[model samples]
Target chain A: MDRSGTMLFADLLGRAKTRIMADWSAELERANARVPGRVSTQELVAQGREVLELLQSAASSGDSDPTSAAYSRLRDLLAEMSRARAFQGFSPTETATFVFSLKKPVFDAFRTEPDLSPDAMSAGLWTATTLIDGLGLFTMEVFQKSREEVIIRQQREISELSTPVVKLWDGVLALPLIGTLDSERTQVVMENLLQSIVDHTAEIAIIDITGVPTVDTLVAQHLLKTVAAARLMGADCIISGIRPQIAQTMVHLGVELNVVSKATLADALALALQRIGRRVVSASPAPAVRASA
Target chain B: MDRIPILKMGHALLVTIQVDMHDQLAMALEEDLTARIAATGARGVLIDISSLEIVDSFIGRMLDSIAAVSRLLDARTVVVGMRPAVAITLVELGLSMPGVNTALNVERGLALIGVSVSGDGEHDAGTEV
Candidate 1:
């Protein structure tokens, strides 16, 4: 708080910079923060040195509050580091350890200050603890946000991948849904299926829900809407992959698909082929008769 | 008043909606289609809406009305080329157009009505009734 105390703290940090960085990096390594192979020892040490230098300068600026404008540079550095670590797949503990690992080195430096009395040493250590703790928690918060963003993006991609419309036959299309049909995914399914129908000029679309785990009223409604959209596009829809459980659920829920549904994709495909005047007949065993003769 | 044109293709009447239809234009189209169906004795009516980006509840109701009127006139109605967004929006708007037959395109619409006629030849025999 006083001018001499601030000068002593700055001199202690300046003299202990190399030792603090070495101890901090060793601590991070012990914590397995660098085990993910995302960051190298050299890069980690460089980052630690930059952060320590910034912390030393900010603390010596006569403002001990880490949240003040004096610590803006330090805060920005920590935020950037946490965001990068988050995108690099660092766990929350590993991300926060970047700041938490510095506490011991800083406390050791404060202890080694011979000229400081017990009260001054305690005050300096407390200031370092508060600043490091605040920054560590900040890193965790930024890391969580980044992780959430990654998860949401991956979920969107997975939903898009799940709904694929395949051209099963010349006049038939198949959409094998593989997950729970939420409203968003259903929209994707409908758009992909309808677009394929238009592209192939298919007359019948077989929507196979066998891979779908369950069918609630809402899912059933989405299916019906998809069917209606396909029919509106001039293609009658035949729902395939209606497992017995789903059938019972549909009946129990009184959710009428109002479209023809088959027990299996093969059956649906066969019926679709039949409607298009095509049959998959096996050749008779005339070769066996010739061999017997 | 801009009137939607209804072209007669053999026994079927074709109405391709290329403009963003207002309530008045949609109503006029419905009246004109009914009059054309009566005058031409058409057995099938095809409404192509591929170019129509938006179909509000009013236009949706007009479509239902047109289908119902056509059915009363003993004609099969097929609404074809509905955009995917429009279909989704229509369903979300709670206008499924239950009575209207839908196809993917005009060719399919014609095929649908044609199949219905051939399948129900006896029904076509009493067109006047």
Candidate 2:
């Protein structure tokens, strides 16, 4: 019974390797179909080596490949992918597309490999899932670290940057700020604030803070600079509704906002009115008025 | 349904608006205030935003319109006591009334209008010039 069990295990490993090689060859054929011209022999050889190493790793890790032919084929196919990656010059979109191209075949073969022992099939899926997860993690890291990457690539995609301008006050300009203000956002803030200060001669600028989660040092610096800049342009800038945690962070960080008068948006407007010499004594209510019929 | 009136404070017209004011409210308020401005020739207008949770595009637009209309009427409009998140959202969303005034609280709003908050409900006028 033990001898039969060992033989069964050997049979399962052989079948799993065969399935992997077959799927890999199919991928190579499809890629070749897309780019039939100028795929140098050297590129093929190099890519072939990558596949070889992967198969070798499988063999060494106790994947009982019969006669090593399956391992050889896998080696050759990986070489092709590596060459394609190199030819594409590692552009993320191109690279992602290439990798994405192979995803289905890999998944399908992995899913349909009935010859694989249940354990072997599960292990293959686990390996593929982990690899895919790692790739996603890597992409996210790239996005954070390389601002230029996103800026250059997604310049047209950021619809928020060029959103329509809606003026809300006679001489009182309201700028609602949401999202975490990064340096990039700071530039956006600077442009909008300065332009509005000049264009409308904004007597008071209300910057409300309902969406920001946390105020970091950089963000604090940006806010301070905007306030200072607004004042320089002869505009009274009010930083309103500072959250509790943000206040604590601002204080602890020693980022002094002494230059800009701080108040709730309401207080800021009141102050703005006072600057303009207007006062409201009664709650005389809205004139029970209706829109023009 | 002119439920609210524009209050004449010291130097500015104090208009206590509905916490959730609308374009219709804005229009009525504008007409009433417009009449008052024509009647008294006030120089500034203050719309209190104390009881608001959120301020959307319509309301933000109305505020801008109110301010613009006030400017045409020669009364500078002010919005006071807007919450932090609301303000930030307006900016991020790029909503604006380029020259409206905003305050954190009523006292500051009152102070903006050159009104000294005297004891009880009395407001003494400060140096106006």
Candidate 3:
């Protein structure tokens, strides 16, 4: 709190900086040595040295409050280091260990100050402990935030990748949906199917829901919206792959998928072909083959 | 206000929207289309909106009304060549435009109305119904 007390702590830290850093590195290695090569020894030493230098400067400014302007640089550096460790998949404890490991080495240095009275030594130790603990908590906060951001980004990518519109024939498109139909995924599915309809000039789109696990009201509504959107783009949709259980559920729920639906993808393809005024026939008739032989 | 031109193709009236439809223009088109349908006695109306990129709720309602008016006049309205974005917007706006038949292009629209695509004599391609 007072200028003289902070000055004494900063002075001790600067004098014994090397000894403190050496002991801190040994402590960190013992705590996190199981994850070999996760961080190189040289990088660890450099990061430890940087943190110590910032702490010494902050203390020399006569401010023991970690949230003060004096400790701003140290706070920012710790937050940045924690974010990097989070992306590298470090646990919260491992990320905080980078800051907490300095507690023992610095306290040991303060213990050997011969000119200091016992009361002043204890006061200095209290300030050091609180400062390091505050920084460790700040580091963990940033780590948790970065991990959540990674998860959100991956979720967006997966949703985009899941809905793929394939052109089954010259005038038909098949969208084989393979996951639960959430609102977000439904939006993606609708956009992809409409764009493909325009590109291929498709007259019929077969939405095969073999991958959908259930047929609830919400899921049925989403499918109907998709079919309606395709119709607006001048393409009719054929919902195929209605499992027996899903059909039963649809009946029970009174959900009418007024669009033409088929029991299998192949049957839907046949109907689509028929609507387009085409049909698949065998290339060689059995009677013709026997006559030729 | 520049008017959206309407062309007579066979027994159908073809209106290709090349400019953005403002409120006034859309209103003008509605009146003009109804009058033309009455005067020409055409049995089908094909609206090509492939170049139309933007539409709000007003345009959506206008399309619905145009279809309704044409139906009263005993003419089948088939809106053709709507862009993908426009269709998505219409769906989101909850204006499905029921009773308005949609086709991918002018050729399909003609086929829907029983107008032969390759026939040279437009008069012979009468309404199917």
Candidate 4:
């Protein structure tokens, strides 16, 4: 009953491969229709044939445990399939269904086996249930892991894309900060701004936070730290783009940004130009601008 | 027993720390800078630390003391050429060193000390005390 159960199931699987595949394909079509991703009939048939072949060999090894070395190749193939389907935006249920759908067809083949003993029949059924269930859970694990990897990669890319230092003028750089300020983001911002100061020999850096949603004590502290770091590198930071609401919130929180700050980027730039001993004067005394219709 | 070379450029004194600093070296530098300020009656002191790659809490405190002592001696001290990594580290360590003035390089440092960087070696107006 122990070893012969899996071997009997393996033998029946090989003998009824064509009939089981036909039933599995029909089950897969019903499951696939509910899923968002597209798996063409030809590709589905090909994958089914491959999985059936691998499963037959693995079951013949008389190891009911899917994690056993005898099932290593089968595990690899399922892991690969789940990873691919995960990237294709398939849900966890859909991926696991690909393995679970094989259960019914394989069990139906057990019923069709002629003159099968009651003991062997029950043992094979138990083996089939455990083996297929283990494989289904495995696909789910692989799917979830791949999804987590994609999320982490996207988080890193977003942080990298958020910080950009622009050279507004010679010796003047501007960092337009959008979104919230976390410690990790502040670290990236400070690094990029400081490097820009050294690279461009910039004397003044304008931190425009107009796009920032709110100003809490933590965010204000991060701003002050960045300012101090810039000052240590011989560049002064001017924080601008203070919305009326953020200004009120800051005042209420008593967040003292000792460094110079202005209401707008233009005002900060003007102050910066003044500090560096530069003046922008109009060349013509005529109208500053003439709108032509 | 190596001493950091201090070159007198007109009314401003230039001290370029080309080697890693130990406790004794830092102490010697602080003493020598004060003595030099008293002896030379220099108006500006520019310490170029661009070559310095590492700093500790002791060094941070030493810089603050140098700036304080030099200020008492009626000399404006501007520490210049701090690397980005050093600045970030200092900030993370909570050592802002507010007493010291910083500049990007020697040229900017000289300008901050009110010394015109002329090739003809012209001594201009000194830093305001």
Using DockQ as the measure, the top candidate is: 4
Candidate 1's C-alpha runs over 4 A off are A2-8, A33-43, A65-73, A117-119, A283-293, B119-129
Error of 4 at A34 (Å): 2.8
TM-score of chain A of 4: 0.92
Expressed as tens digits, the lDDT of each residue in A1-293 for candidate 3 is 45566777898898999889899888877876767778886688789999999999999998888889999999999989999999998888888888998899988899877898877887788788878888888888889999999999999988988799999999899999998999989989999999898889988899999999998999998998888888888888899999999999999999988888899999999988777767798887789778899
Alpha-carbon deviation at A82 in model 2, angstroms: 14
TM-score of each: 0.88, 0.35, 0.87, 0.92
iRMSD in angstroms, per model = 5.6, 10.3, 5.0, 4.2
* Tens digits of per-residue lDDT for model 2, A36-108: 5545434543443354345445444443432245344553443344444544444444334433444565567
- Pitting candidate 1 against candidate 2, the one with the higher lDDT is 1
Choose 1 or 4, whichever is better by DockQ: 4
Q: What is the lDDT of residue A186 in candidate 2?
A: 67
The RMSD of every model to the true structure, in order and in angstroms, is: 4.1, 19.9, 4.3, 4.1
Give TM-score values for chain A, per-prediction: 0.85, 0.44, 0.89, 0.92
Q: 1 or 3: which has the higher lDDT?
A: 3
Q: Write the per-residue lDDT of candidate 3 for residues B1-129, one digit (tens) a residue.
A: 699999997678999999999999999999999999999998888998889999999998999899999999988888899887888888888888867888888787787766432353343321111
Whose TM-score is greatest here? 4
**Using DockQ as the measure, what is the rank order of every candidate, best first?**
4, 1, 3, 2
TM-score of 2: 0.35
Off by over 4 Å in 3: A2-5, A34-37, A40-43, A67-69, A286-293, B115-129
Clashes of each: 4, 76, 0, 0
Error of 3 at A193 (Å): 2.0
Sort the candidates on lDDT, descending order.
4, 3, 1, 2
Compare the candidates by lDDT and give the number of the best one: 4
Assess the local accuracy of residue A280 in candidate 4 as a C-alpha lDDT between 0 and 100: 84
Per residue, candidate 4 scores C-alpha lDDT tens digits across A115-229 of: 9988989999988998999999988999999999999999899889989999988999999998899999999999999999999999989999998999999999999999999
The CA lDDT at B96 in model 1 is 81
